[model samples]
Target: MDAFTTAWAGLTGWIFETLVQPAFYALGLMDWAEDAYDWLDFGLYGLLTIAIVYLVCRPLEAWRPVEPVADRRAIRTDMVYTFLARLGVLPLLAFVLLASLQTRWEGWLTEEGLLPPTLEEIFPPLRAAPLLAFLVYVVVLDFGEYWRHRAQHGLRWWWALHAIHHAQRQMTFWTDDRNHILDDVLAALWFGGIALLIGVPPGQFPFILLVLRLAESMSHANVRLSYGRLGERLVVSPRFHRLHHGELSAGAAGKNYAVLLPVWDWIFGTADWNRDAYPRTGAPGTEEAMATGGWVRQQWAGFRRVALALAGRG
Candidate 1:
């Protein structure tokens, strides 16, 4: 892990110095250098994640697809969402906004001589076992994600934005990132806030994110596969999550809200353990534009829906 981290740092630093730093220099944005560096790191990791997800998921999708590739255009639009959300403007903006806030908050707490609470601090034994500490952080963050997903469905206005994700009839690995920008922002806040509260170490943040994202991507893959009865209860399977996206399972009626672990859903009574069910996936009653339109159209439709929902006219 240390070797990999070192190599990743070296590559990111070289890219920043060679390309990004010079571009920032020309734009007279040297003041934003620190944040820009972090953004670059995130973008690089996003690129790596995309490649890995594609290589791992594409074959499974081809092997046992639940649905045929009928709408190439919709899949392409999802790819646009994947690229934009992962490695484009979103990363830069999220880093600039959230990183600064974290820095100021942590600095303030430090000058007051107060340490932020962490799992290690809560359980001293974990402090000596870095791997166990990392796993605990993963579980904690995933628990937070499970609740956030439930809220997205339970809340009317949030569902207005989240509907864009479920609107896809052609769900693929790329579909994992098909979310409204506002929805994405709320998710980022929900995730980053949990990390802050638990005091997840800075170094562990990237790997934790990578693990969760890979699991999500695989869960969204258009594959006819399951982890069997007992295995399905352990980790989320494609069959399990496909049921969550089934046409009948949208909005507040949805099940299988867990991101990585099905245990959360099992414990919370949201688990659907029917391993043979790979029902058709889509959000019924979604706007046509949101279901099949291009990137800008989907975003606009989601925005319009949320606006109406907020106004109580949806």
Candidate 2:
């Protein structure tokens, strides 16, 4: 593990210096070097996650696919989403927009003598065991995600935005990131706010993202697999999450709201233990265009739906 860590650091540093740093330097943005470096690492890790998910899930799908590839085009659209997200295109924009606002917010808070509280400050023992502290943060963040997911399903306007993700009947690993851009923004704000509140260390963010995203992708995979009854309770399995995306689970009627841990769903009475079932995916009563439309069409549809819903005409 030590050797692997050293090698990974060396490679990440080399790539950032050779490619990312030089571009920033040339553009007179060296003042933002530190943040850019982190973004670079985020992109690299995201790409690597995509590769790893593909390596692991693709074979499983081929071997024991629940359904055949009847809609290659739909899967291809999801691939576009994976690239847009895992490549950090949208995140880069969000970072730029959020960074200034965050700076101002923190500055104003500092002026008012009310600095944000960190988990470490609240629980000093966590500072001594960084790993345990990180795990604690992970649990807290996952808890936030579980509720955010419930809100996505519970709130009518939010459901209009999130319906894009559930509209994919041909679910695959790529489907995990196939959300409406507005939905993604809302999600980003939701979690980003929680992270700031708890003062999640910037250093620990990428690793947390990688772990959560990998589990999420795996949960969406088309593979006919489970982690056994007990194991399924510990971590979300494909069967566990597929039920959340199943036809009957659409809108406020959803279940299995956990992302990484099933405990949330279990606690909230949202978990369905019918592990043997893998029902057909996609939102019932949604337009067919939402299920198989191109990226632009789907995003536009989500926005339009939200607008109509908000206007009391949906």
Candidate 3:
């Protein structure tokens, strides 16, 4: 392994030994010394697995031909909007952080108490069980996320929050974060709440979030990274996700919405792989439809639209 990989492994090992092990011991689950063994196994094994994935997948992504689109000014505008919208996530983040701190401070909450106990908590039989569990949880959460994405398209109220994401006329990595604060809040609540209720471990939560963010960033990246059939089945590709943002007429608006997995869309009959026949991708509704009195006015208009629908006004 290279210096960076070695350092990462070492750090991961240390974290498992110091933090994870102690937590397990406090829960009266395992001996403290086992933590060291767990750390070393996870650090080395995890590093090797990720390294192999990158080595094999990176080249395939590079070989795909991607069409280039230039619209810097529009992209920049979208970035600004996204940045502004992300500011809304701060309060929600704070709420989650506070809840975490409270759970930790209480001391009554064991590792298992947290939704989705970490691999270590779930499988104490084998040293490698935690590592295996970690991988399983990643896939499971991705599956869950795919359904959540589909719901956002199928439900009208959910679409209100998701529409903020599609508001951008341009696409880029940062464009992925461009969403209304309410939308971000609802998304966090939906995914995190469901994961917690299902007992997903807190330790594993970070890994899940990291994987999702990496997928989101990669899918929105300007560079092309198509993995053809194999990639399509395994993970969501940029092309598959781009179809979700396709600008179609009213009749064909909410088509593809799966995030990390395409299976959900395919299963639900929402998959759209007709790249050659896809309409030009853009935000739905006209510029005038988006333009209200101002930002506040537009926001109010959106709120009113939702309220009216709830009251059966629309």
Candidate 4:
């Protein structure tokens, strides 16, 4: 296994040993019920994240009012695509399960024993360094994610899974999660792999995941949460991220692909934030063409189209 995988396993073990176990004991829960409680906690939080994303996007109607595409049917079609995309979550769950198994079987390395160190043991200076380390860790993790995202676009085969994400005709918070099953699995692998390689303790992964998810939801939100010029310089805002979803105008479609930081886009020359002109949303083809064949057929058609182009038959 890679260093990231090793560290992630160690960290997860540390988290359960430290925070989760203590919490279970304090709550007087049955020893056997701890795992169930953890699952419940994660599920509840996931639903809450979805609800928050919806709430944030609902208000965008009034803020930066643009002419609705006058295509309710297309919107409905996109929603269906989004629903089908939820099936992608299954592969993500599988990756999580696999990672857990791998880590447990391999066991953790420590100074004195084969077992992973406890959270306190791993980070003895938590009182002085927790916040600082966390901030640095978050930035590093975001940077890794940014590069992984760029690779998905630049690499031809990877784009197949990613194109499902871009299939959305509308850009909203929910659009953030509209990825293919393969895409989701690859993403988890990247994120989890990187975290483990860096030796991030298990206790920290949950909190990090929480923060990243919230930030991702906020980035895709349709609400007018422009961070002004200064805020845009520091972190990604809705305005900045929306440009990534903007349709190609005069051959400028693949710009602004950064996830958490606009700095990467700016540095890499992909940033295209034009506040002066409102962008047109949706993919290249018309909704009617996309919807005629139904979801499965449409996906097959898209794949075929790409294949033909690759074979120089288009």
Candidate 5:
């Protein structure tokens, strides 16, 4: 891992200096160099994650695909979402907003001279073990993700936006990030707030994010595979998550909401332990445009649905 990271750092540095730095220098935006570097790190990680996922899951899909890729166009659309999301256009917007949006979001308690303590403050032992602390932060953030995914289903308006994600009938590894823009912002706030509360460093944010994202992409892969009984219970399996995206399992009646761990679903009565089930993926009662449309069309459709849901007219 050390050797690999060193090599990766060299590669990323070269790319940034050769392309990114010169562009910033030309534009006289040297002041944004640090943020630009961070953005570059994000882009590098995103590319790595995509390549890794493709290398690992693409073959599995070919070997034991549960469903055939009869709709290449839909998969292509998801690929665009994945690239746009991770390349830092939409996600960068969310990262920049996190500080201002969550500065004092503890509500009246913040006004009452009470504030939340970081995990390190609560458990001083964590300070000495930064790696362990980061893992703990990952666990905490994953727990928060479990609930945020629930809210995406349980809340009508949120689900209106989240429905764009489930509308992918031709779900693939690329489909993990096929979300509405508003839904993406909400996810950023949910994830960023949890990160801040747990005292995760901005530097370590991408690491945990990479782990979760890899798991998510694997889960959504077309592979017809499971991690055995105990392993499935311990961590989310493709079979476990495919059930969550099953035709009948979407919306408020969703199941298997855990992002990284299946334990949350097991504990919360949302787990479907039938290891043999791999029903077709997609949401019901949605227009075809959302499932098959271009990125902008889907975003517009999601906004309209959210407005309708909010108005109690859906």
Candidate 6:
């Protein structure tokens, strides 16, 4: 592990100095170098996530697809969303926009002598067991995600943006990232805020993302696979999440809101444990543009829906 960490750091340093540093120098933006370097690591991790998700889920999809590939165009649109997200377009935007707010918030807390304690600080035994602590962080973050997902469905205006995600009739592994840009930003804020409050380590954050991303992509896979009865309750499966995307499960009628773990759904009464069901996906009343339009068109339609919903005309 130490060797791998050293090699990884070497690679990141080499790439930054070889490419990013020169670009910063030429653009007279050395002030932003530190943040850009951090984002470069995120970008590289995003690439690894995309590769691992595709290599694992794509084969399962081909082997046991619940639905055939009837809408290539729709799948292509989802691929665009995946690339935009996994290539760091969305993360970079969130980082740039949130960095100032985070700095100010941290500064204020420091001035007040109220800087928060990490989970490790609260539970000192966690310091002696890194792997266990990582699991705890995963559980906490997944719990936050479950509630955030419920809000996306329960709140009308948020649902307006979130409907784009449910509008995909041809959901695939790529469909995991098929969210409205505004919804993505809001999600980043919600998730990042919780991470900040709990003091997740910067090194562990990307791995947490990787673990969740792989699970989410697999959950959205077209493949019809489920962890058997006992296993299904432990980890979410494609069978479980596909039902969440079922046509009739849109908006306030949804279930299975857990992102990585199914325990939250089971505990909160949102789980559907039918291992035999793999219902057709898509939101019933969503605009056609949201369901089948190009990326920009879908974004526009989602934005318009939010506008109308906020105006009480949706």
Candidate of highest lDDT: 6
**Model 4 ranges off by over 4 Å:** 1-36, 67-92, 104-127, 201-214, 223-225, 249-253, 285-314
Off by over 4 Å in 1: 1-10, 26-28, 107-113, 204-209
Model 3: pairs clashing at backbone N, Cα or C within 3 Å: 115-199, 115-200, 115-201, 116-199, 116-200, 116-201, 117-201
Each candidate structure's count of clashing pairs: 0, 0, 7, 7, 0, 0
Estimate, for each residue in 6-26, the C-alpha lDDT of model 1 and write its tens digit. Answer: 999899999999999999999
> Between candidates 1 and 2, which one is better according to lDDT?
1
Candidate 6 lDDT tens digits, 1-314:
78977887899999999999999999999999998898888788788889989899999999999999999999999999998998889988887767776788889999998986799999999999887788898899889999999999999999999999999999999999999999999999998899779977666656667777888899999998999988898888999999999998999999999888899998999998888999999999988999999999999999999999999998
lDDT for each residue of candidate 2 in 192-272, tens digit (9 for 90 to 100):
888778877766655666667778899999988889979999999999999999999999999999999999999989999
- What ordering of candidates by lDDT runs from best to worst? 6, 1, 2, 5, 4, 3
Name the runs in model 5 displaced over 4 angstroms.
1-3, 25-28, 100-116, 204-209
Could you tell me which residue pairs clash in candidate 5? none
lDDT of 4 by residue, 159-273 (tens): 6446656655555665666555556667877877676555454444555565666677667655556777677767777777766666662122477777877888788887766
TM for every model, in the order presented, reads: 0.92, 0.94, 0.62, 0.68, 0.91, 0.95
User: What would you estimate as the lDDT of candidate 4?
Assistant: 0.60
RMSD of each: 2.3, 1.8, 9.0, 9.1, 2.8, 1.7
- Model 6 spans with C-alpha error above 4 angstroms: 1-10, 205-209
lDDT of each: 0.89, 0.88, 0.56, 0.60, 0.87, 0.91
Output the lDDT of residue 30, model 1.
97
| Model with the higher TM-score, candidate 4 or 5 | 5
Residue 262, model 5: lDDT of: 88
Of the candidates shown, which would achieve the greatest TM-score relative to the real structure?
A: 6
Better of 3 and 6 by lDDT: 6
Q: Write the per-residue lDDT of candidate 3 for residues 139-187, one digit (tens) a residue.
A: 6776777777766666676665456566544565656655555556666
- Taking all chains together, the TM-score of candidate 4 against the true structure is 0.68
